[model samples]
Target: MAKLVLTRLGGTLKGRALTPNPLPRILWRSLSTEGESQDPSIDPFLHSAPEGLAFGRLTGIGRNTLKTDVIHYLEGCKLSINDVKFDYNRAYTPVGVLLQFPSRSSFDLAVRQTIRKGRLYKLEKIDRSEWDLKTSYDGKAVLLQGVPRNALQEDVERFLSGCNFDPSSFQTFVRPGFPDPIRVAIIQFPTQVDAMNAFCVKNRSFCLNNPISMRVLQ
Candidate 1:
């Protein structure tokens, strides 16, 4: 036998039916107002199914705060997510996430919004540059450090272009963290020879008003 319990809040269903096996305690907690908002606008659970999806990484988050912090942020944006996987084995700190968006537009919106949250948390693209060690570089990647937080894509491209690397073939990334002047960036070169050249000139600064250090990804 089972008992049906119904409750409504903010024009949404808030209660659940109880069965012999019962639902997980976590599902019930999600029904509560623990990390939810009374206002429907920012409520993560108030959205309709999204039409597309995108993926991003969230650092500085822990196992306990996964639902409350990361998922809550996504919900606040009105984007529906299907699943979230953590990269515990790859990253020692285990601060990674794969966000499934409803559509490309939804993903773009999430990326734009979460970039603002990067100051407080590590949020960035989970592309090959971040993961996929072998394919990420293809033995032609250079790691740059000490990049100014405000450095734009063009700024990095301009500097790398001056070094005779095809700016189109290269990709840059800045890990999310506090507003520090120095950050890490990875540049994937077109060929291993170019990577070796970039690596040969180590400890030299480029890409901003201040010089940044570069190293070949091993």
Candidate 2:
């Protein structure tokens, strides 16, 4: 009976030998318990904005352009300006100005009047959804194809900065089951206007390589 018991114990040890580095069951249980303890209602990166505010992009406007000039231009238009921001690219070149208006209808009317009056700057309304980095519902993200496999995240970020936009996050992806692995990058911007400007100014080469093509995610 002792010999039979020893044989059974030896068999169990041999089976365990197949998995030499087995993890403790308690550790796995702890990990699972921690995962289950997390609350689903909380998100760390969500951004919220006030309701009734409208956003618009203005081109052909310089950073040094006097604010008083703009105010005088819009005087008697019945529209109120909440805020004005000037955005610049990595090259220190001015991209344009972003304006916040009190009402969407007033913003649209202002754009039309600017176009009809042949103002120095052109205006276009941008949806608020474009500012939400989480959803990226309005193609606030861009994808670059044919990126060199050896390229690093810093290289991509630097190149994008030169184009006048900063990336919130940069990620590289490889397709599975392909004979030769093809790598691409998905870059998310803080705002949709940046992504749109990058897309509009296409056909530019970066990394001292081929002229890469960029696609805006819809």
**Clashes per candidate (backbone, < 3 Å):** 11, 1
List candidate 2 stretches off by more than 4 Å. Answer: 1-136, 176-179, 202-204
Stretches of candidate 1 exceeding 4 Å from the true structure = 1-136, 176-182
lDDT of 1 at 26: 67
**The candidate that achieves the highest lDDT relative to the unseen native structure:** 2
- Please report, in order, the local distance difference test score of every candidate based on alpha carbons: 0.58, 0.60
> How many clashes in candidate 2?
1
What is the per-residue lDDT of model 2 for residues 1-218, given as tens digits with 9 covering 90 to 100? 11222225745633222324655677333535554665544644332433377877777865445344555665554543335544444322347656667776767777877877787778887775543322312346676766677888887776676465545577787643256655667777667777878767653566547455676654
96, model 2: CA deviation in Å? 34
Give the Cα-based TM-score of candidate 1 against the true structure.
Answer: 0.34
TM-scores for the candidates: 0.34, 0.34
Q: What 10-residue stretch in candidate 1 is worst by lDDT?
A: 129-138
Q: Write the per-residue lDDT of candidate 1 for residues 1-218, one digit (tens) a residue.
A: 87889888889988777878865666333547676557665657666644544556666665434333556776645533234554543212344555545466766766676667665566665563443332323346676777777888788776665454666654445555456434666777777787777667645756567687775543
